[model samples]
Target: MDAHFARVLADEQDDAPTPGASAAPPASSSRAAPTAALSQQQLDALVARADAQELDQLDARSLRTLVQALERRVRSNALARAKHADAPERFLESELALHSELARWRHVAAAPAALLPELAALNAAPLLLGLFAHDNADIRLDVLALLAELTDAEDDLADADALAARRVWVRALLEHRLLPLVVTSLEQLDSAPGVEDQDEEAAGVYHALQILENVADLEPPACAQLCATTVVLRQLLRQVAAARRFSANKLYASEVLSILLQSGAAPRAHFMAGTVATGTATAPRDDSDSSKRRKQAGAGDLLDRLLQAIAPYRKRNPASEDEEELVENLVNALCSVLLLPAAQMHFRRLEGLELALRCLKDRAQYVFSGALRMLDLALMGDARNCARLVEVGGLKALFAVFMGKKKAKKPTATATATTTRRAKSEAKAKEEELTMSILSSLCALLSPAAAHDVFDRFHAKFVENDMEKLDRVVDVFVKYLGRVEQRDLAGDDDSDDDDDNDEKDENEDARYLRRLDAGLFTLQRATHVLAHLCASSRKLRAYVLVKLHEHRIDMDVLAQILKEQLAMLRGGDSDSDGDGDGDKDVTDTDGERAKMQAQRTLLVHLLSTLQAPTSDAASSAVEPKQEEAKHET
Candidate 1:
């Protein structure tokens, strides 16, 4: 191949004359060239030779010639296929041949900039889009493949000029109204009979979706163009609704919906209003009246639909990994929507908390993690949700998961060790996260006025006569705080170890740090819950203080934890941070900081209340003063 390329370059060089003699070919040669244009037979032979092995030997000019020829053949073949449209098989065969030639063109025309002009000259966007209406599904699929190649962003191109040229070509394709057509084609293919007869429909949908995703990823103008074509959003939502559990179409549709929703192109009111009528194939209504209606309905409707979509998977085991992921995504969508006030109201109305509670029992960690997060959001500041949660026995359920005893205990003797230690580590991390979420939910519930009765009920169940449950709660706080204290005492010794530590030791240290962080979070939440209880109910405070004194629970530990947290908030040394563990920004660090401040404030209030005189003590002193006054009289 190298020799052939060299020989061709040499022949061109030999035909060239010195610059002073002539810059152009001789007039006699030019006249003969026009008359000696290749015949159809000669063109076929040339294409066959290039297709076999000579394509790589072509120079830039020869490559352009080959690409142009292939483009012309594609056009001619499409025309021929249309002419024989009555013979479906023959049309398909010709379409396949056309796609093969285009694929070859894409291969040899490695410089995308070189072939783009030829494609533009052929009006390739419309030509390819036109095939989408063909009766043969295979032909439509082939057209999609070609279009994907043509519109693909040339990321492999290193030169700025080439990349800009590719972008311009893409913009041209978009300008030619390719997005609307792609949407329309997907809608048609989705409704086509026997779409499942082959993989053609799926392939076409995948490519169509890819094109839309790519367009959406372009500059704001291109995204606007895509968003303006409202049919795509409507179709995508319908596809998402119709897709079976764990289907690829469902996953892609969800992803596209997320992108669209996040783009700020689709009005949140529209999604919130539940305006997407299921199975409706019409274009989206984006007018002021529609927006007004969406506002009137609010996000409640959307929250309802999301809840319904995810409700079925609440307790059921997923059939596959994909199904689990789909469930998690749906739950996440639910959580995102629940951020709205209206959605939170509707969530309680729709029994969303119950669904979340059921999901908390799911074997898939992601599914339950999402549920835990949603519960956290729903209970954040919504008193009505807290009341509903208590009504549904959510408090007990949370305690069950928090204590890891909802299901029967498995004795350690019967446990089997696994080879994958990482899996075990991950499981433990998830368990900690779950515990953290449960504590967060409890804290949220404890903060609301409506939750006072719920707290009373919890106290009656766990703290009334049985000190065991109460002690357990106290134990969680002390256990983590003690760990922090121990780590702090050993900090100086570990400083030298940190420098000499191997990778495995470093990893172990990191894990220990993470565990320490989780512990501090847990301790903070425990303190918050205790503070709330003490501030809300005097009798509860008296009972807790008595228990603390009886059990010799170190009030100093609570003070120490508060001091460390306060120091961290003030940007103190790493050694003075929570549990004396170094601080790194984790996802919930900001939230944790805020919670710690609130906990500190609450702790101050509780300590003041505990030390202040009780009503009985004041009344007793007043009685003695009154008797003394009577004796003096």
Candidate 2:
């Protein structure tokens, strides 16, 4: 008897495809020939016996032989009759007998390890998708648990047959007909705190993500079939929302949502977004005014929920990470909406935009860049929106960020040469580069009058004794001026060359330059505001003068300083760069120490005695003419 059982099992094992082997045939077709021979009554009898928990009572060798036979039937699909074929009661009995025995086998702690693989193979085979839809919860959970194990096995990803079998089981699990039961199971798994240990719960979450990952790979039609059920969508959203607060579970929720979005479930995403938004609006906050407290708390709660939804996306993995990167793709799509004009309007009224911006501010560098790219898209061809960015203090905030170092320092090494290392030096260079980008954005939204107001509001903060921060702010100012000058230079160069080009090319280039110049001029105006602090604020005047005198100012930046000092000297009248003639009293001191001391004296004296030029009749007379020309256009 042992020899006979060994021979049978050996043959089946030999036939088992290597982990990387070609796809196996679907189990139903392969197993159908054997199942056709059994009757329904016989199957029912086996189920009764199995449910009666009689598996261990069978002779151990006999049980092993039965398991081998059942595995062969399951893997070959011999346990199920062909579609629309007359399924005999006996064949049904045989399949049920296999299922019942496997279900009861879980009670046997000493069951052979091979028994698990055999049972898992059966569950993941094509024949059991329908069987798991059986009304018995224990049966369904047992089947699902086994299938989840198979997905983690090597053969699952490599063998098309195994993947196909698993796919069918997943479909059955998520199908509308079985959604309620599956949802209940998911809910229990999620809510029952101690039912699963940390590792098991983590595995369960990973399993759920894997299922979504698999479903996402299917065609749109197949995806629609799975996602079309409202119950499935709502359940997924609720699970994700609830899971978002738990940092450990957040990644799983993120994975699921990513799959849903990538599967072309746009409405579902929008629906989830709406729920997140509404929830944020109604959540309560900690406050003394009961009404205000309720409102803020509700908003805070809602915001926390949204943060979870978006947090996983706050970091980027490389492009080769997955077939469909749900996190990156969803973030891209949602950013489009959030940065829209309509959304921006609401963003100001609620915490959504603020949260998004904060994430951009504090998140991984690539994420920050991506978020800014989205903002760039929102502002493109929309000058008013660009202006609105300035109104919300975006310029100052972005300038501060641009000057921040990319790599953080170790606290213990702060006092060493670590602060002055080459990495820090290079980072400073990069900081200047990013500072210009922020300036470019602000320049596109030029409002000379508003720039002045913004500068005054931040003047005190900018003039504080923190030299590092002050220098960073100054660096941003210089870069802003550079952007403006570059635009001006580009415009002049284009004008001279436009006549030599074809009319169409000339027109296009001319338009581009105009757009660029507008942006640059906006930056120019903002710099002018900062320049005002050089004379209008006494402490700032002294600080700037000291910096000006110091040898630390790079030569490339001296030109902007010269322009600013000239403007201050001229009583706030804007000075064109060409006016830097040798006639001015300005003198370059050669020694670094002497120059620094001289600059300090110059700035302090200038601030103390500075005065705005009177509005002479000639200048007052020209204002209306410029206004008239602007209005005419």
Candidate 3:
């Protein structure tokens, strides 16, 4: 602006007014070019060009000076507004100048390191964050736009100086309460009329979400900070966990909410506890009105509201890709919270199991996978949930899906590179997920309990229809077992494969083994399911032995197969990179090996259930009554 004034002053001519005849000067003589009062559009365009040009001419020192100048203009105009409220003439012009001056900083985005440290040193974050509440919506939005660009992540950037600079800048912003201001801007723009059309291309809500995601992604600490107060969580819940009209912003909020929940257990606990504190106690949010309305309209914790939002997809699949992804985000967020026992209890209280079962039954291509994941997480180790699952008749859907056709395994020539392989890998992953989910559900349902009849209804499924359910489960176990055996027995004909397995690198060896043994987990879970059924009921135990006999699988053979699995698991541990943490990969492989050991233990106990009578296959089918009587005698 000083340069513009200087140019205007330089162009002025000191022509004497004595030439009155020429005072009118043929009505066309130009004394000097007028300083054009730029419209907001022209001003914005001018600022856009100036941003690039000015920054190009600036060195580190010059950039810092430019920031200080903009800061002065902002504060000066703000002071004018406060002092001269009745006089628009005094403040209005400076307001536009400040808006333009702020607009020029956007070019710093391309190289934010120098500018951010400078801003922190100058204490410019409060001024910048304070602009969020300015009377002019465009000014508030420009603040967001600038912040969004400045905070944009440089994913490939590894400059030590830049990282340290960003850390300081972020700290400064948070110190002045950046998040609450952002939420206010978010609600204002989201609810404000005609703000979006100011630039049909730049969506304010999208910008707000991008700002959040970029910050959270660049710094894990930011994720905790974002969720520390309930304002962010509550606003995000309002966006995702309610029946709000759908938009891309809804999907984005859902994604950020998931990150927050998964960041640490504190956020998850807060969500489950429905604790809505502001900072340490309460935050001043723009959505306070909507918050109360939401509490009234939707009762229960955040988990329950998530269920309500997610419930629609069970019967009707997402109508569009955005909606599908949105629901996926909600389900993902719910899954993260479900890791807490309190969340699981809340979920079961809300009858969330029934909803998941319905979704599994709907098998709508879009809804089934997400619902299966949520259900898988929900019933993992919770007996009450599994009991509710059984009570709600979830078993039928699990069996129906379990009985679905097995994918064909055929040898094929390796193909040229294309998307088909990626698609196949995805499909294969989904298949594994579905199989594991049902396996888990069954294991949870038929688990041992103090009351004999607790699992009798579940046990009876194996005995009804000539033991159809049990036969199918065994077939699944056999099928997965066959896959494992075929691959293991093939014995690495590929020289590369053998080399990879011999490599001490855990990742490489695991990848090689994973490709060969895709059936391992399905096999483990199937083994667990069968083991539970055998141990839970003597009548079911007799049927299991007969089925194994019919399939030519003797007790010794079953034990041998299970032992081979254990050996594979144990041997994998031996291949760990000798990180001194073990030739053990103790953290990663311990749980899996332990699970396999437990599976083997179950098989061993099942094998020991009846030692005296396996010689006659026909007589192996004995009654619970006869077995009990013998025990009594």
Candidate 4:
């Protein structure tokens, strides 16, 4: 027999039942007894029997019995190795075998929960963690892989007991302080020279990082612990800072950092302060205290790092889908940091807004959306940022896109008819979204203090460009409202159809409704910008009124929207006062009610501003009377 079988047989013989105590089952028996309550001796004998018969020949029951036996044997062997430190090679072999068996078992079903808690118990955690320092790189990799499996909480087990059992394993991992061990192993692996081949090293690193991610996902406190650790934070920062652009590690590091920052796990102020202190060497003023200087410097450095990470992608789009995702995560991290006042200052100083503007011009929708969002956040309640935006001619650049001068795409002539249509539809949708984003940014720029000057700048630009920008905004508003009206009319009609046709019609109607909803949202944002323009400047208001008078269709569109909104408000108020389905959807209608109120307010503001006489009109009228007096003289 094979040497592996010989050892199994020896162990089985040592613990086998006495011949007089119990009889062995007949070989002809089709169904074997369940092994859920098997003792150690019985399990060992089962393993011996499996070795003799070979795993492939075993029936389902026999295979399950062998798996239970292997779990018990691996547990006992790991414990023995932990108790007797002298036999390192023996312990290594046992661990290797256990990992192999576990991998096999994972292919069949969820891991037996008993396996992890046994390995992670006080006695076994140290032994299992010791594998990180094993002489063999492959062994260390295996240990990392096994731990990753042990800590994973994403397995979709339907059985409540299995899920509870899995949670037990996760708790054991946390209770035994395995997270710190995982971090330590990652640090060592990253610092150590090439252990095996390139693939092996990469695999090891990937598994280790995955373990950290899983821990963070399962336990918030563990994530907090990681964030609080200076060494770990530094290491993660280095990974992000030093990683080759668009590399997997860079993406992973960005994701981990995003989680840390967004979860409030790390003390944002402390981390920001640390970055500033380390990255700069400027001495504080004589009156400034060391703690204050440290904090200011840290906030600056943190902002600088985030911008630097985002800077690379401005000139170059991501090379792969993963890198694209990394760009999003990096942008989110930048946005989170920009929430700090100190960080916002650093952002402006670093010309972060310029980078975002450049990204907004990128072809990728996600990059553009992220950049637009960042710009919106930066400009919110910060007049300085709004000034900077105007200083950089951001207004002109955004207006170019807003006016549809910057075509999103030009389809190739070689495409099929359907493909061309789809491409055009996608391009049109993107154009709409981009226009809305620009309008949103413009709205953010129109704070009470900055509104006057910002409006003046826009008015000058509109006149210089022959009022094309204003015309574009008006046209978009009319077009979207018309589409919304068309959808409402179409929704009021019903046509009967066969089941299949009904389903298809329902799907098409659903898609059309979504488009209609998006168009209405765009209309709302455009109206907001129009309202701001009119409210802030009398000249712009006069121009809008003149344009509306010339385009009766546009005037009617705005009037219809206002009238419908007023009717809806009246209906909702009456419903609230009455008992007619008043309580049925009170919670659901609150948001719709608020939105209608805002739209009504903007419409009212636009109308009032347009009706008020401008200084230009008054001056022109006075000049004509002066001419009449001169003629009389």
For each candidate in turn, the TM-score is 0.60, 0.41, 0.73, 0.62
- Candidate 2 lDDT (Cα, 0 to 1): 0.44
Question: Whole-model Cα lDDT per candidate?
Answer: 0.55, 0.44, 0.62, 0.57
Candidate 3 Cα errors over 4 Å, as ranges: 1-51, 112-115, 154-168, 187-202, 275-300, 405-454, 485-502, 505-517, 537-633
- Give the true-structure RMSD of model 2: 18.9
Q: Cα lDDT for residue 557, model 4? A: 47
**1 or 3, which is superior by TM-score?**
3
User: By lDDT, is 2 or 3 better?
Assistant: 3
Which model, 3 or 4, shows the larger lDDT?
3
Residues 1-633, model 3: lDDT tens digits: 444433443454342122222111111113212333346347646757766776876567877787688878877777867775664444544665676677567666666575677778777787788777677665666677788787775742777777777877877887888777787767666565554354422366777877887677667666656666536777777777455677677788888888878776666766765732211111111234635543543454456567667876766666677887887788788888877766676677656777776776644356676777777777765677777666666667766665563332232346444655765566555655565655555554444452333354455555666677678778867777777767755544433444454463665455447644557667666666666566555566677888888878765555555565566656655654343553322322554455445544554554454333333342233223321211100
Candidate order (TM-score): 3, 4, 1, 2
TM-score of predicted structure 4: 0.62
**Candidate 1 residue lDDT tens string, 206-282:** 88887776666554345445655555555666665623435677777666666655554233334555533321111
Q: Could you tell which candidate, 1 or 2, scores higher by TM-score?
A: 1
RMSD to the hidden true structure, all candidates: 14.7, 18.9, 10.3, 12.5
What's the lDDT for residue 488 in model 3? 57
